[model samples]
Target: MIKKFLLTMCLLAALAVGGFLYVKQSVTDFIAQPLKIEQPHLVTVERGNNLNTIISKFVDDQWINPTQFSTLVRRFHPNLTQIKVGTFEVLPGMTFEQALNTIINGKEYQLAITFIEGSTFKEWREQFKQAEYLEHETDGLTEAEIARQLGIEHDKLEGLFLAETYHYSVGDSDLDILKRAHRKLDVILEQSWASRQDKLPLKNSYEALILASIIEKETSVPSERERVAAVFVNRLNKRMRLQTDPTVIYGMGDRYDGNIRKKDLREATPYNTYVIDGLPPTPIAMPGKASILAAMNPENSNYLYFVASGTGGHVFSKNLRDHNRAVQQYLRQLRSKK
Candidate 1:
């Protein structure tokens, strides 16, 4: 009877060990198995989202088993608080471990959008449509619509967004990109405006921006910007019409053909400096940092007019007579060289 009892105890011990090993194997397989998804998904963790919120999102999306997903996530990723707050793409066949790594390591796929300086609103809209984050073949939103969505007024948007590369996730709105660009511009402009010179002719920062835009369009040379600003300042002080060719181009509006004809000059328009005195109604284009600084602190000079020399630079003159003479010289030289 004692031998039989000992044998029964050994059999029970063996059964317990087998059960423990089976449970361990099942847990390992569950952790290793990929979660199959029928469609691609996106998850956004807001700036203040916590670990519980993120886990709940996974469960709600049916991407993980709610009962075991949290335990699995904690087991694989000890640093749950390190998960980045941003939009992430959730792909099919990704294990719980892989998803955790993707969020923690910032391995989320990004969509890139590039805005080139000097692009018009229409042009920017076209480029936005081609972005990977945006839906293709959809009727695109207008610039006004985008600005409205971003809580920016239409008039305040021109020349507001800076040119740079931007990143977003799939299905990001056009307004989202505009807002990002505008925010960057706002910070840069504020910093620049704070350091501006005192006693500038511009009534406000906007006027300074307008002058800078003119300087930007007038010349591409960094060294010439201050000189160009000086010319405009002299004209403004003397109460003479700016007569900037770019202003005339702006006056022609969307009707402006490829050429700047004599008729366009004679026609009266709000933006036509040839006809109207002082600055134009608005800026002609976005100015770079160099141009903005030049407008704020123009070089003091007697130069009242400037004409493009055949070279990349410009020829400045103190008076109309000198300007005419310089024009003749430059034009003759250009003809002779050709």
Candidate 2:
């Protein structure tokens, strides 16, 4: 009688162990099952979302038991309960476990905005106006008002922001992007000024920024940055008017209709370098790092003038006679093309 009772208890114990093993294997297989996404899909987890909310989506889509998924999450993957708040891209054929890992790891999708070198702050604002998913907090605000908010001392906000690609998440404001760019510009300008070449004729970093903006507008060719810098530097050293056309155009504001006449150059404005004795009152545009560095450390040259070459570059000249020849050559190229 005792031997029969012991055998009966042992058989029941064996059946219970087998049933537990079977349930564990079934849950593991369910977690490893591939998602039904035919293509890539974006999943956004907003604030106040938890494991239940996330799993509810999968449960609705896959016809899976929500209780089962929730029990597994609580038992094995408790980290999924605290997922990140951002947009996530889930690819096809990814398992539920893998997708949960992606959300928990928090590598959110990022969008980018690019500012062209030598582009004006107004152009940057226009880009922000057109960018998708970015909050336009700076929209309809004047430059002076925006400058005050940015803590800039003056209303002259040109060249204060750096030109580069800035990444942001959804719900980020345009002002947020500008803040980051401004901080980066400050660090770069401080570093460049600390290691600048001697006798650059720039009294301060702001002056360097102004000169850099001029250099940026002067040439699109990378090699010609130093050349353009030298021309402006030599003019500054000689106490001569910079006589740059872009400065004139900037001073003209919306009155500038593409063509710059002699009358425009002679017009007296704070930004008109032709009419001003030294650098402009403010930078003309947002200059890149190369132009900023060139302004701080110009090459040793006596180049006082430059004219656009026919082949998308500039011809530098030290004397007025040579500069006139290059100008004539540029006009001839334009006429020949016509």
Candidate 3:
């Protein structure tokens, strides 16, 4: 009787092991099967989302059997408790294992934002605020507070970020993009300063940044950038006011009615180059690398004035009489347009 009982116990143990092996193979096969979706599907992994939630979504969509999928995940990625936050694209024919791997690695979507040259810091912030993919950590913070958080010591925050397209993942913060732009600006500034032409009227790299911002706002034409910088450099050398109209518009702030008149130039704001002796207290707009390079190495010319030449470019002049002629030509062109 004892021998019979022992033999029966061995048989039961063998059957249990066989059943476990069969279940394991079935789960593996389930994971290896093609997904149910006919087209590509977007899977958004929100921050702190549990693995079960992700699985449940797929299960609800009839993409996979929950029990089999859970068994497969346990057998394979047993330690994976959370998915990375981002927009992930799951292809129609991908196996469950491939989809899981894609989610875990966070390699789904690439997002980009551009900060345009000659745009103000305010505009850059507005763009950041409007971006849906980026996490807005700087939202509702004052300019000073935001600058402080980024460790930027500039009294005025305008033009601190570089003008370029920054790429990031979905879970990235606005501060991350800001830091990237700031670092890029810092790198470019140092290089420009190190290679700058000698005896420039500007005091330091910060002043170069200020001049670069002015140059960026002066003209959009690539050929005119150095000429514009040269005009400003000449004015600085001759102790003439760097009377650029963009400076007055910036100084006017909320009061500028899309026009500059005698009073705006006459107002003694720190940014009003018509009233101030030298560069503004801060950069007026974000400058690109070309503008910064142009500021550092202005063309050797006698040009001290520039006016819009009816076209998108400028008419540069060396003296008041020529500048006046250019201004008259600009008026004639405007009259013709009307």
Report the number of the highest-TM-score candidate: 2
Stretches off by above 4 angstroms in model 1 are 1-85, 89-99, 107-112, 134-156, 161-173, 176-199, 325-338
Across 1-338, the per-residue lDDT of candidate 1 in tens digits comes to: 99999999999988898976665555455545576687777777777877667767776766776554354545544675577877777678887556766777766678787775555455667787677657543256555665677777654455666667888776577777777787876676677678777666678777777788788778888899999999998888788888888878866868978788888887899878888889887777766677778888889788998998888899999988989988998889889987
TM-score for each of the candidates: 0.67, 0.84, 0.81
Taking the candidates one at a time, how many backbone clashes does each contain? Answer: 0, 0, 0
Which segments of model 3 are wrong by more than 4 Å? 1-53, 60-70, 73-87, 91-98, 104-108
Error of 1 at 253 (Å): 3.3
lDDT of 3 by residue, 286-315 (tens): 999999999999999999899998878889
Writing each residue's lDDT as its tens digit, candidate 2 over 203-225 gives 99999999999999989888989
Could you give the candidate ranking by TM-score, starting with the highest? 2, 3, 1
Q: How much lDDT does each candidate structure score? A: 0.74, 0.88, 0.87
Where does candidate 2 clash, by residue pair? none
Ranking by lDDT: 2, 3, 1
lDDT of 1: 0.74
Poorest stretch of ten by lDDT in candidate 2: 63-72
Query: Per-residue error at 127 for model 3, in Å?
Result: 1.1
